[model samples]
Target: MRLALTSDNIAGACEAVVAEMIKAAQGEAMPYGGDPLTEQVTKMFAELFECDVAVFLVSTGTAANVLSLAALTPPWGSVLCHPESHIVNDECSAPEFYTNGARLVGVAGEEAKISVSALEQAINKRMGDVHSVQPSAVSLSQVTEIGSVYSLAELQEISQLAHSKGLKVHMDGARFANALVSLGCTPAQMTWQSGIDIVSFGATKNGAMAAEAIVVFDKNLAQKLALLRKRGGHLHSKMRLLSAQMLGYLSDDVWLNNARHANAMMALLQKGMASIAGVEIIAPAQANMLFCRLPVGMAEALLAQGFSFYTGRWEEGVVRFVTSFQTQQADVEDFIACARDLSTSHTKTS
Candidate 1:
């Protein structure tokens, strides 16, 4: 069995999501999210969020995030976010492209969660200045890139601060389900109720075939987001497949279940790694992702032994690991066992 500790995106579609896609494939879907299934999925999200909001379906997390920001930010505007946020570091300037030149200003902080003080500094540094990029909005990642989660209190603080400064709060919730299940909070409590104006609710990362939602809590922002999505070329034709995936993911609470399993397996891997030598967790393994540093050779050895994970540069001799919705306990144990053996071999050699 191959152990996977790469990214949640590496996991396959959940069976429920796949089955729904198959079911949708049999019908002629109304193009561009006009189908009844899309309406149902959007309604489910509004209910899950415990409020009336506008939802736009898209095919990728980048599209969801970029388009959501595009709806809120004007040209010559700037978005405040963590230095390591996916949109800042990984999206290849899709946010810039979508926002028609809105810039992303990286906030400095530990744990990959922006500190209110730091945000204040970043915002204050660019005030009343025509030459400086004006701060237009703030984006907070629910489960941050380092696998650290923002508590509701933390989100509230950030939200309050952003609003106080007249900046809209946008959440890049690529792992919204994982963070929700981890926090055990109602969707509203985690989002609009806490001052978030918009959210990029992701399904592709959790278990969908390929889908995400840009949810605008502010009714006024909805029309703009819909237009932006269409202009960005994300409006899907025969979009029922996308809606079907979300329908299955949310139906019967499969989304929560899959996220819970992924989180549990990460916990198991973390616990197992704690007992091994030369392994140190770089971040709290709260969600499906884990950022840990292991001995140099262990990554290579694990790959040789049929394990898969991204070994991000770990200083001089360490690497990172991740877990996903499909991670099995056996896979976790086997990877740990391999690490244990590698540790022993290294010790003997030294």
Candidate 2:
């Protein structure tokens, strides 16, 4: 039936998370994240990270990222990140707004994973120059925009570089679970233990109703993040609902399971696509995303078949197919079949 290959938000909430929210709604709990559930969820996150991390819940990934950057950077500072990163491109100045005028300096990277060299150059270009903003933070995406995953070693190299240059590292982990599941690495291995200072742990895109957490590894930055999230108007009055979503998502490793399924679907889609005619993969299918170029006719036919995905500005022949936790294997097969049929029809017509 209805196949969604647009974004992870198309996925519905997990039953456990839904039940937790319903249960939370039945109680007379304190508001503004002072409730027991919120406290318990934060504790769970801390334990998961294997450190006393500060966890702040937000309604969206953008809020989690922008608010975390606000806590890390000052008004006059800047954040160094890949040119195609969500924080630099998707946030639409949310980082700047939350940071009271901090700017983002984009580094050159193909898959939105900041290379140590590119980061160093980007930060160096802004240094020893009063006219330019000072580099205060470096942000990287775990599962990059081009569907590439950063290895733990790569993250360590980038993190060590940022810290050596007196900058903190922030990770826009919108597809964190996808990357983590693929890497088969613990959260701590990809983060704090590897020099990450904060992470925007995304849940809405996975299976939660609407939830994201800003994880601050450094305790000193915790108070500032709390104040910033409150001032940014992200402090939910009925914060237990958000907490419930996160708690249930992480309760029995549902988050990892969901991500694993999504990644598997992407892999299947990628394999099916590679066998088709006139279809080329633009990037490696490392996580839940598949960036590829299809024949103009096949792209148009797929669009006509109720298959929805980005055409990347309606170019002559290119598209982006995004898989999610809810993307079914049958849907992937149907889409591949559609592409095959379209290619055959186009050949006959031509």
Candidate 3:
């Protein structure tokens, strides 16, 4: 009856990764992503993306994102992104710091998806002037800060618009697999084929214990990431630990399976939540995240009963519940039951 759907399960790196890690420890391998497994994973990425991709593994999504942005933007330039984007808000200005003082400008849009007009405005508002930060790149989140996703057309529109402005495109794909499943598109179509120049290909949020990657679609931007990752202090000496997690995450299509389960659970919960009075679905029930509103007292009562979800960060009474590979139908049911019970009580009293 414990439903604490806040983030992905870090229950010791999933089964497949654990096996890979144990094998990695049993023998010698190159350090700093020069090992056989790293090479093989690189091939996996290239094949998965349907192009010659330059891949770099990191231990955290923030590192993957900041390092990639640093390579794409000069210190004097700026990156335009959704106001709630991880780079703009959550990463503690790491993108700006990593890029040595590049500016992070917010692009306003609905559902945290930046619109083409907003991009045009953000880019033109002092871009390429000697007195202000130049627009060097743009960053987008696949499964946006809210639950909604960018459609293929949305991605193409933004990417094409950014490129025409001489800005490279980067995607914060922390929920890459979840969005991929939701959109039913190939990785290539979701990214490079749609004009994405770089991607922070995330696995930790799906099933990996601690693994994320920067995938370079524009092959020319490849070399600098290695040095940037090392300088940023994410170059693991035992590189195979990170490599093993990604390898296993990609194997048997576990990443997609995990995401599919999470997304399915989100869909189920959204459907059930609609019937609960006073519970408002605040955002589109897309991917594995949901935004909804509950009465303040009911929220407190649910948390007191050990049903946990994010609250009070974005706004009062509105919260986000995230499903992961470990989230269960029973958990969802119990949560809904608790919320419904509290809602009933609150209504009767009011």
Candidate 4:
């Protein structure tokens, strides 16, 4: 059984992107994002988002998030995020560093989606107290750390609440396409129409090689972000390679197709795991990831049998299985079989 916890390891850049990169390497293009392909993808994103969006291409998701947040918040202001959000848990205070000491306050929520009431309370918790970090932004992770995505209604409620409180909304969309395919909503509905002010539109985690974008809905933020990206050393001189990958990713709805396949594989794995005697689906298997608890020792046994995955990374007593466009049906079934065999043997002994 073969499984990978991160998209970087599961599959390489899609074939389309590989071909584009090779083509880009053989040709001459303008440096520092002046190439035609870079300009074209920017237009493509605006069309897809159904609005005029300022798009900045970057090599990493962390840079995308930090730069976007830096543009929106000041050193003393705070950005709200779910406890398990990638910004809060994984980014190593880069948001604070990029924003020059801005704080990241955790908002409580169920299934990794921040709750509205908790967010409102947090926003106003230290409203005028100079001692506390004033809430200036709310960062949401689409297809959250535990794989649950906020529904369209849920996103709208949170965004509206944040905007009403004079706070901007940002989405860490590392798995943007996966969440989009899962929700079956248009890009505008999920972000700007729902009041999101900015997005770190991540394509690297899906199928692109080191391509991520910072998409700004607010023109004011976009203006500041341009300087920040260049000053922060994220601006690539040979930028067409990144642009080409994004172009390949978005063309003909390839991103949506890849997401659909990954989600379907997760659904298959989640369903089969649920039927096993000693397995527990720990979180909502909403997208291309699953968080489940196996019979004690089952995880170790499965690993011994050649399955590679993430266990106890997010929490103890649970394992994470991430499916990508490259995951095959046979791998899913074989994994399920391995778990069942261990569960059955453990049950008989007990």
State the C-alpha lDDT per candidate: 0.87, 0.88, 0.89, 0.88
What are the RMSDs of all candidates, in order? 1.2, 1.3, 1.3, 1.2
Question: TM-scores of all models?
Answer: 0.97, 0.97, 0.97, 0.97
Candidate 1 lDDT over residue span 1-350, tens digit each: 59877788888999999999999999586788889999998899878888888888888999989998998889899999998999998999999998889999999788899988999999899677999889989998998888888999989999998898889999999999899999999889989988999999988888998989888899999888778778888888888989999999999999898889989998888888888888887786788777777776777788898888776554654556767788889878888888899999998998
- Compared with the true structure, what per-residue lDDT tens digits does model 2 show for residues 37-99? 999998999889998988999999999989989988888899888888888778888888889
Cα error, candidate 1, residue 321 (Å): 1.7
Query: Model 2, which residues run further than 4 Å from truth?
Result: 314-316
lDDT of 4 by residue, 259-340 (tens): 8988999999899999999788999678988888888899888888888888766566788888888888888888888788
Worst 10-residue lDDT window, candidate 2: 312-321
Model 1 TM-score (2 dp): 0.97
Model 2 residue 131 distance off true place after TM-score fit, in angstroms: 2.3
TM-score, cand. 4 vs. native:
0.97
How far off is residue 212 in model 4, in Å? 0.6
> What's the lDDT of the predicted structure labeled candidate 3?
0.89
Clashes of 4: 0
Candidate 1 residues lying further than 4 Å off, grouped into runs, are 312-314
